[model samples]
Target: MNTNKELEYCNVAVWFDRSTLHAMMQALVEAGLNVAWKESQKQFRVTVYTQHGTSDLTLLRLNGAYKLDELDYCVRDMRLALVLYQFIEQAKGHAIVKMMNQDKIVVKNIRYGEAVRIVEIKGAEKKVIYEKACSVTMDQVIAALKRRDAEERIPVMRLELDYELATLYDAIQAKDTAQVKKSKDRLKQLRQEMLLLEA
Candidate 1:
Protein backbone atom coordinates (compact mmCIF):
# COMPACT_ATOMS: atom_id res chain seq x y z
CA MET A 1 0.00 0.00 0.00
CA ASN A 2 2.99 2.31 0.57
CA THR A 3 4.62 3.90 -2.46
CA ASN A 4 8.35 3.43 -3.18
CA LYS A 5 8.91 7.16 -3.08
CA GLU A 6 7.32 7.55 0.36
CA LEU A 7 9.19 4.48 1.77
CA GLU A 8 12.53 5.53 0.29
CA TYR A 9 13.84 1.99 0.87
CA CYS A 10 14.90 -0.91 -1.28
CA ASN A 11 11.85 -3.16 -1.45
CA VAL A 12 9.98 -5.49 -3.76
CA ALA A 13 6.35 -6.43 -4.16
CA VAL A 14 5.96 -10.22 -4.36
CA TRP A 15 2.96 -12.44 -4.84
CA PHE A 16 3.18 -15.77 -3.02
CA ASP A 17 1.15 -18.17 -0.94
CA ARG A 18 0.44 -17.42 2.70
CA SER A 19 2.56 -20.42 3.77
CA THR A 20 5.56 -19.17 1.83
CA LEU A 21 5.25 -15.70 3.37
CA HIS A 22 4.95 -17.26 6.83
CA ALA A 23 8.10 -19.25 6.21
CA MET A 24 10.04 -16.04 5.52
CA MET A 25 8.75 -14.49 8.71
CA GLN A 26 9.73 -17.63 10.60
CA ALA A 27 13.25 -17.31 9.26
CA LEU A 28 13.48 -13.73 10.57
CA VAL A 29 12.14 -14.81 13.96
CA GLU A 30 14.70 -17.60 14.09
CA ALA A 31 17.40 -15.01 13.52
CA GLY A 32 16.52 -13.35 16.87
CA LEU A 33 14.02 -10.79 15.67
CA ASN A 34 10.66 -10.13 17.27
CA VAL A 35 7.82 -10.30 14.73
CA ALA A 36 4.10 -9.84 15.10
CA TRP A 37 1.40 -10.04 12.47
CA LYS A 38 -1.48 -7.54 12.67
CA GLU A 39 -4.58 -8.95 11.02
CA SER A 40 -6.44 -5.61 10.92
CA GLN A 41 -3.81 -3.88 8.78
CA LYS A 42 -2.45 -7.11 7.26
CA GLN A 43 1.03 -6.01 8.29
CA PHE A 44 3.91 -7.46 10.27
CA ARG A 45 5.72 -5.27 12.81
CA VAL A 46 9.27 -6.48 13.33
CA THR A 47 11.72 -5.38 15.99
CA VAL A 48 15.41 -5.97 15.43
CA TYR A 49 17.71 -5.79 18.43
CA THR A 50 21.28 -4.76 17.74
CA GLN A 51 24.28 -3.79 19.87
CA HIS A 52 23.84 -0.11 19.02
CA GLY A 53 20.05 0.07 19.28
CA THR A 54 16.75 -1.52 18.33
CA SER A 55 15.09 -0.97 14.96
CA ASP A 56 11.50 -1.52 13.84
CA LEU A 57 10.03 -2.46 10.46
CA THR A 58 6.53 -2.87 9.09
CA LEU A 59 5.94 -5.43 6.36
CA LEU A 60 2.64 -4.94 4.53
CA ARG A 61 0.81 -8.05 3.33
CA LEU A 62 -2.53 -8.42 1.61
CA ASN A 63 -3.93 -11.59 0.08
CA GLY A 64 -0.79 -12.96 -1.63
CA ALA A 65 0.89 -9.59 -2.11
CA TYR A 66 3.63 -8.45 0.27
CA LYS A 67 6.16 -5.65 0.47
CA LEU A 68 9.16 -5.40 2.80
CA ASP A 69 11.03 -2.12 3.14
CA GLU A 70 14.74 -2.80 3.62
CA LEU A 71 15.63 0.64 5.01
CA ASP A 72 12.52 1.11 7.12
CA TYR A 73 14.35 1.46 10.41
CA CYS A 74 17.50 3.28 9.37
CA VAL A 75 18.31 5.36 6.32
CA ARG A 76 21.03 3.85 4.16
CA ASP A 77 21.14 0.92 6.59
CA MET A 78 23.26 -1.58 4.69
CA ARG A 79 23.62 -4.06 7.55
CA LEU A 80 19.92 -4.25 8.31
CA ALA A 81 19.05 -4.35 4.64
CA LEU A 82 21.52 -7.19 4.04
CA VAL A 83 20.07 -9.23 6.91
CA LEU A 84 16.52 -8.88 5.61
CA TYR A 85 17.61 -9.41 2.03
CA GLN A 86 19.48 -12.60 2.85
CA PHE A 87 16.50 -14.00 4.70
CA ILE A 88 14.16 -13.24 1.83
CA GLU A 89 16.64 -14.56 -0.71
CA GLN A 90 17.14 -17.77 1.26
CA ALA A 91 13.41 -18.35 1.46
CA LYS A 92 12.98 -17.79 -2.27
CA GLY A 93 16.00 -19.95 -2.98
CA HIS A 94 14.58 -22.87 -1.01
CA ALA A 95 11.33 -22.65 -2.95
CA ILE A 96 13.16 -22.67 -6.28
CA VAL A 97 15.28 -25.60 -5.17
CA LYS A 98 12.15 -27.55 -4.33
CA MET A 99 10.67 -26.76 -7.72
CA MET A 100 13.84 -27.78 -9.55
CA ASN A 101 14.07 -31.02 -7.59
CA GLN A 102 10.47 -31.75 -8.55
CA ASP A 103 11.23 -31.18 -12.25
CA LYS A 104 9.05 -28.11 -12.38
CA ILE A 105 11.99 -26.11 -13.70
CA VAL A 106 14.93 -27.13 -15.87
CA VAL A 107 18.11 -25.76 -17.35
CA LYS A 108 17.69 -25.98 -21.12
CA ASN A 109 21.27 -25.25 -22.16
CA ILE A 110 24.54 -23.45 -21.42
CA ARG A 111 26.62 -21.88 -24.16
CA TYR A 112 30.11 -20.59 -23.47
CA GLY A 113 32.10 -18.24 -25.67
CA GLU A 114 35.35 -16.31 -25.52
CA ALA A 115 33.83 -13.12 -24.18
CA VAL A 116 30.45 -14.21 -22.88
CA ARG A 117 28.41 -17.15 -21.63
CA ILE A 118 24.69 -17.84 -21.77
CA VAL A 119 22.49 -19.91 -19.47
CA GLU A 120 18.92 -20.79 -20.35
CA ILE A 121 16.49 -21.81 -17.60
CA LYS A 122 12.95 -22.94 -18.35
CA GLY A 123 10.16 -22.89 -15.78
CA ALA A 124 6.67 -24.43 -15.66
CA GLU A 125 5.11 -21.33 -17.17
CA LYS A 126 7.34 -21.86 -20.24
CA LYS A 127 9.09 -18.60 -19.38
CA VAL A 128 12.86 -18.47 -19.52
CA ILE A 129 15.30 -16.16 -17.76
CA TYR A 130 18.50 -15.77 -19.73
CA GLU A 131 21.52 -15.09 -17.60
CA LYS A 132 24.74 -13.76 -19.03
CA ALA A 133 27.72 -15.50 -17.52
CA CYS A 134 30.27 -13.14 -16.02
CA SER A 135 33.04 -15.57 -15.07
CA VAL A 136 30.32 -18.03 -14.04
CA THR A 137 31.22 -21.70 -14.46
CA MET A 138 29.13 -24.82 -14.99
CA ASP A 139 29.91 -26.03 -11.47
CA GLN A 140 28.75 -22.73 -9.98
CA VAL A 141 25.58 -23.00 -11.99
CA ILE A 142 24.97 -26.50 -10.69
CA ALA A 143 25.60 -25.38 -7.13
CA ALA A 144 23.34 -22.38 -7.54
CA LEU A 145 20.56 -24.55 -8.93
CA LYS A 146 20.83 -26.93 -6.02
CA ARG A 147 20.93 -24.09 -3.48
CA ARG A 148 18.40 -21.89 -5.30
CA ASP A 149 20.95 -19.06 -5.27
CA ALA A 150 21.57 -18.09 -8.88
CA GLU A 151 23.38 -14.85 -8.01
CA GLU A 152 26.47 -16.63 -6.80
CA ARG A 153 28.96 -16.87 -9.65
CA ILE A 154 32.51 -18.12 -9.99
CA PRO A 155 35.09 -18.74 -12.73
CA VAL A 156 34.37 -21.41 -15.34
CA MET A 157 37.87 -22.83 -15.40
CA ARG A 158 37.93 -23.23 -11.64
CA LEU A 159 34.57 -25.00 -11.75
CA GLU A 160 35.72 -27.39 -14.45
CA LEU A 161 38.86 -28.28 -12.53
CA ASP A 162 36.89 -28.82 -9.32
CA TYR A 163 34.38 -31.06 -11.10
CA GLU A 164 37.22 -33.15 -12.54
CA LEU A 165 38.84 -33.38 -9.12
CA ALA A 166 35.55 -34.51 -7.63
CA THR A 167 35.16 -37.11 -10.34
CA LEU A 168 38.64 -38.41 -9.64
CA TYR A 169 37.80 -38.80 -5.95
CA ASP A 170 34.55 -40.58 -6.75
CA ALA A 171 36.31 -42.99 -9.09
CA ILE A 172 38.92 -43.72 -6.48
CA GLN A 173 36.23 -44.44 -3.92
CA ALA A 174 34.46 -46.83 -6.31
CA LYS A 175 37.77 -48.62 -7.06
CA ASP A 176 37.14 -48.16 -10.78
CA THR A 177 40.65 -48.17 -12.20
CA ALA A 178 39.59 -47.16 -15.69
CA GLN A 179 37.43 -44.31 -14.42
CA VAL A 180 40.22 -43.13 -12.10
CA LYS A 181 42.64 -43.05 -14.99
CA LYS A 182 40.18 -41.19 -17.22
CA SER A 183 39.38 -38.63 -14.51
CA LYS A 184 43.06 -38.07 -13.77
CA ASP A 185 43.82 -37.46 -17.46
CA ARG A 186 40.84 -35.12 -17.77
CA LEU A 187 41.91 -33.20 -14.68
CA LYS A 188 45.44 -32.81 -16.06
CA GLN A 189 44.06 -31.48 -19.32
CA LEU A 190 41.75 -29.09 -17.50
CA ARG A 191 44.65 -27.74 -15.48
CA GLN A 192 46.58 -27.04 -18.68
CA GLU A 193 43.54 -25.34 -20.23
CA MET A 194 43.08 -23.21 -17.15
CA LEU A 195 46.72 -22.14 -17.27
CA LEU A 196 46.34 -21.13 -20.90
CA LEU A 197 43.23 -19.10 -20.10
CA GLU A 198 44.95 -17.38 -17.20
CA ALA A 199 48.01 -16.58 -19.27
Candidate 2:
Protein backbone atom coordinates (compact mmCIF):
# COMPACT_ATOMS: atom_id res chain seq x y z
CA MET A 1 0.00 0.00 0.00
CA ASN A 2 1.20 3.53 -0.77
CA THR A 3 1.53 5.93 2.16
CA ASN A 4 0.63 9.62 2.24
CA LYS A 5 2.52 11.84 4.65
CA GLU A 6 -0.22 14.46 4.84
CA LEU A 7 -2.80 11.87 5.86
CA GLU A 8 -0.48 9.99 8.18
CA TYR A 9 -2.13 11.39 11.28
CA CYS A 10 -5.60 10.52 10.02
CA ASN A 11 -6.78 6.99 10.57
CA VAL A 12 -9.43 6.38 7.93
CA ALA A 13 -10.91 2.91 7.92
CA VAL A 14 -13.56 1.53 5.58
CA TRP A 15 -14.99 -1.92 5.13
CA PHE A 16 -16.04 -2.64 1.53
CA ASP A 17 -18.60 -5.25 0.58
CA ARG A 18 -19.85 -6.15 -2.89
CA SER A 19 -23.12 -4.21 -2.68
CA THR A 20 -21.36 -1.17 -1.25
CA LEU A 21 -18.94 -1.02 -4.20
CA HIS A 22 -21.78 -1.39 -6.71
CA ALA A 23 -23.67 1.42 -5.03
CA MET A 24 -20.51 3.54 -5.20
CA MET A 25 -20.29 2.95 -8.94
CA GLN A 26 -23.90 3.99 -9.31
CA ALA A 27 -23.23 7.18 -7.36
CA LEU A 28 -20.34 8.06 -9.64
CA VAL A 29 -22.47 7.46 -12.70
CA GLU A 30 -25.23 9.63 -11.26
CA ALA A 31 -22.62 12.37 -10.81
CA GLY A 32 -22.10 12.35 -14.64
CA LEU A 33 -18.83 10.46 -14.64
CA ASN A 34 -17.90 7.45 -16.75
CA VAL A 35 -16.98 4.42 -14.63
CA ALA A 36 -15.94 0.88 -15.48
CA TRP A 37 -15.00 -1.96 -13.21
CA LYS A 38 -13.96 -5.62 -13.18
CA GLU A 39 -14.73 -7.68 -10.13
CA SER A 40 -13.34 -11.04 -9.12
CA GLN A 41 -14.11 -13.15 -6.12
CA LYS A 42 -11.70 -11.27 -3.89
CA GLN A 43 -10.64 -8.15 -5.78
CA PHE A 44 -12.13 -5.18 -7.64
CA ARG A 45 -10.38 -3.01 -10.23
CA VAL A 46 -12.23 0.28 -10.79
CA THR A 47 -11.33 2.91 -13.39
CA VAL A 48 -12.84 6.35 -13.64
CA TYR A 49 -12.60 8.02 -17.03
CA THR A 50 -12.38 11.80 -16.58
CA GLN A 51 -11.53 14.70 -18.90
CA HIS A 52 -8.20 15.12 -17.16
CA GLY A 53 -7.15 11.46 -17.33
CA THR A 54 -8.10 7.94 -16.35
CA SER A 55 -7.72 7.15 -12.65
CA ASP A 56 -7.40 3.58 -11.47
CA LEU A 57 -8.20 2.10 -8.04
CA THR A 58 -7.71 -1.47 -6.94
CA LEU A 59 -9.35 -3.06 -3.94
CA LEU A 60 -7.99 -6.33 -2.62
CA ARG A 61 -9.16 -8.77 0.01
CA LEU A 62 -6.30 -9.96 2.21
CA ASN A 63 -7.02 -12.84 4.56
CA GLY A 64 -10.61 -11.68 5.12
CA ALA A 65 -9.41 -8.10 5.66
CA TYR A 66 -9.87 -5.56 2.88
CA LYS A 67 -7.20 -2.84 2.49
CA LEU A 68 -6.69 0.11 0.18
CA ASP A 69 -4.82 3.40 0.16
CA GLU A 70 -7.73 5.88 -0.01
CA LEU A 71 -5.86 8.87 1.37
CA ASP A 72 -2.99 8.46 -1.07
CA TYR A 73 -5.45 8.55 -3.95
CA CYS A 74 -7.06 11.65 -2.49
CA VAL A 75 -3.71 13.36 -2.26
CA ARG A 76 -3.01 12.53 -5.90
CA ASP A 77 -6.44 13.43 -7.31
CA MET A 78 -9.53 15.02 -5.72
CA ARG A 79 -12.35 14.22 -8.18
CA LEU A 80 -12.61 10.52 -7.45
CA ALA A 81 -11.74 11.04 -3.79
CA LEU A 82 -14.84 13.15 -3.20
CA VAL A 83 -17.10 10.51 -4.73
CA LEU A 84 -15.47 7.76 -2.75
CA TYR A 85 -15.82 9.72 0.50
CA GLN A 86 -19.52 10.36 -0.13
CA PHE A 87 -20.14 6.73 -1.05
CA ILE A 88 -18.36 5.46 2.05
CA GLU A 89 -20.27 7.87 4.26
CA GLN A 90 -23.60 6.73 2.82
CA ALA A 91 -22.64 3.12 3.25
CA LYS A 92 -21.92 3.87 6.87
CA GLY A 93 -25.56 5.07 7.17
CA HIS A 94 -24.83 8.82 7.37
CA ALA A 95 -25.89 11.48 4.88
CA ILE A 96 -26.14 15.28 4.69
CA VAL A 97 -28.44 17.02 2.22
CA LYS A 98 -28.17 20.72 1.48
CA MET A 99 -31.32 22.76 1.12
CA MET A 100 -32.08 25.66 -1.23
CA ASN A 101 -32.02 28.27 1.53
CA GLN A 102 -28.49 27.39 2.73
CA ASP A 103 -29.86 25.17 5.49
CA LYS A 104 -28.76 21.52 5.61
CA ILE A 105 -30.42 18.30 6.65
CA VAL A 106 -28.49 15.41 8.16
CA VAL A 107 -29.85 11.91 8.55
CA LYS A 108 -28.20 9.05 10.39
CA ASN A 109 -29.58 5.53 10.65
CA ILE A 110 -28.16 2.94 13.02
CA ARG A 111 -29.19 -0.59 13.90
CA TYR A 112 -28.89 -2.41 17.18
CA GLY A 113 -30.07 -6.04 17.32
CA GLU A 114 -33.58 -5.91 15.74
CA ALA A 115 -34.21 -2.18 16.30
CA VAL A 116 -33.19 0.68 14.05
CA ARG A 117 -32.54 4.23 15.24
CA ILE A 118 -32.90 7.23 12.95
CA VAL A 119 -31.86 10.81 13.66
CA GLU A 120 -32.78 13.87 11.60
CA ILE A 121 -31.14 17.28 11.88
CA LYS A 122 -32.11 20.52 10.22
CA GLY A 123 -30.52 23.93 9.57
CA ALA A 124 -26.91 25.12 9.40
CA GLU A 125 -26.41 24.87 13.15
CA LYS A 126 -27.05 21.11 12.99
CA LYS A 127 -29.71 21.13 15.67
CA VAL A 128 -31.39 17.87 16.52
CA ILE A 129 -34.90 18.33 15.13
CA TYR A 130 -36.39 14.84 15.44
CA GLU A 131 -35.46 11.43 16.78
CA LYS A 132 -37.21 8.09 17.25
CA ALA A 133 -36.70 4.34 17.47
CA CYS A 134 -38.57 1.69 15.52
CA SER A 135 -38.26 -1.94 14.60
CA VAL A 136 -36.78 -2.87 11.27
CA THR A 137 -40.25 -3.52 9.83
CA MET A 138 -41.69 -0.26 11.16
CA ASP A 139 -39.83 2.25 9.06
CA GLN A 140 -40.81 5.88 8.72
CA VAL A 141 -38.07 7.87 10.51
CA ILE A 142 -36.49 7.46 13.94
CA ALA A 143 -33.39 8.08 16.00
CA ALA A 144 -31.08 6.50 18.52
CA LEU A 145 -32.35 5.41 21.91
CA LYS A 146 -29.47 6.78 23.94
CA ARG A 147 -30.81 10.34 23.76
CA ARG A 148 -34.47 9.25 23.88
CA ASP A 149 -34.81 10.02 27.58
CA ALA A 150 -35.94 13.52 26.64
CA GLU A 151 -38.62 12.28 24.23
CA GLU A 152 -39.81 9.68 26.72
CA ARG A 153 -40.78 12.52 29.06
CA ILE A 154 -43.33 13.78 26.56
CA PRO A 155 -45.56 10.73 26.89
CA VAL A 156 -45.37 10.86 30.67
CA MET A 157 -46.36 14.51 30.65
CA ARG A 158 -49.23 13.71 28.30
CA LEU A 159 -50.43 11.02 30.69
CA GLU A 160 -50.26 13.53 33.51
CA LEU A 161 -52.47 15.90 31.50
CA ASP A 162 -54.97 13.10 31.05
CA TYR A 163 -55.14 12.62 34.83
CA GLU A 164 -55.40 16.36 35.41
CA LEU A 165 -58.18 16.64 32.83
CA ALA A 166 -60.11 13.97 34.70
CA THR A 167 -59.72 16.02 37.87
CA LEU A 168 -60.96 19.08 36.01
CA TYR A 169 -63.96 17.06 34.81
CA ASP A 170 -64.84 16.19 38.43
CA ALA A 171 -64.37 19.84 39.43
CA ILE A 172 -66.84 20.88 36.74
CA GLN A 173 -69.35 18.29 37.98
CA ALA A 174 -69.24 19.83 41.50
CA LYS A 175 -68.99 23.34 39.99
CA ASP A 176 -65.83 24.17 41.97
CA THR A 177 -64.38 27.36 40.48
CA ALA A 178 -60.92 27.27 42.18
CA GLN A 179 -60.18 23.57 41.34
CA VAL A 180 -61.23 24.05 37.70
CA LYS A 181 -58.91 27.02 37.26
CA LYS A 182 -55.97 25.16 38.83
CA SER A 183 -56.48 22.12 36.57
CA LYS A 184 -56.66 24.31 33.49
CA ASP A 185 -53.42 26.04 34.40
CA ARG A 186 -51.67 22.73 35.03
CA LEU A 187 -52.84 21.39 31.66
CA LYS A 188 -51.45 24.39 29.87
CA GLN A 189 -48.09 23.95 31.60
CA LEU A 190 -47.98 20.26 30.58
CA ARG A 191 -48.73 21.12 26.95
CA GLN A 192 -45.92 23.68 26.90
CA GLU A 193 -43.50 21.13 28.34
CA MET A 194 -44.38 18.62 25.61
CA LEU A 195 -43.84 21.25 22.96
CA LEU A 196 -40.41 22.00 24.36
CA LEU A 197 -39.45 18.34 24.07
CA GLU A 198 -40.27 18.46 20.36
CA ALA A 199 -38.20 21.57 19.89
Q: Provide the TM-score for each candidate, comma-separated.
A: 0.32, 0.36
Error of 2 at 110 (Å): 18
Which residues of candidate 2, in runs, are more than 4 Å off? 1-12, 62-71, 75-79, 92-199
TM-score of 1: 0.32
Which candidate ranks first by lDDT, i.e. highest?
A: 2
Off by over 4 Å in 1: 1-16, 69-83, 90-199
Instruction: Pull out the clashing pairs in model 2.
Output: 118-142, 118-143, 132-143
Instruction: Write candidate 1's Cα lDDT for 75-174 as tens digits.
Output: 2333444454454454321111111323343332211112122223345356445544354466644544565322122134445666888988998999
lDDT of 1: 0.45
Residue 42, model 1: Cα distance from true site in angstroms: 3.9
The local distance difference test score of model 2 is: 0.52
Cα RMSD of all models vs. native, in order, equals 17.2, 17.9
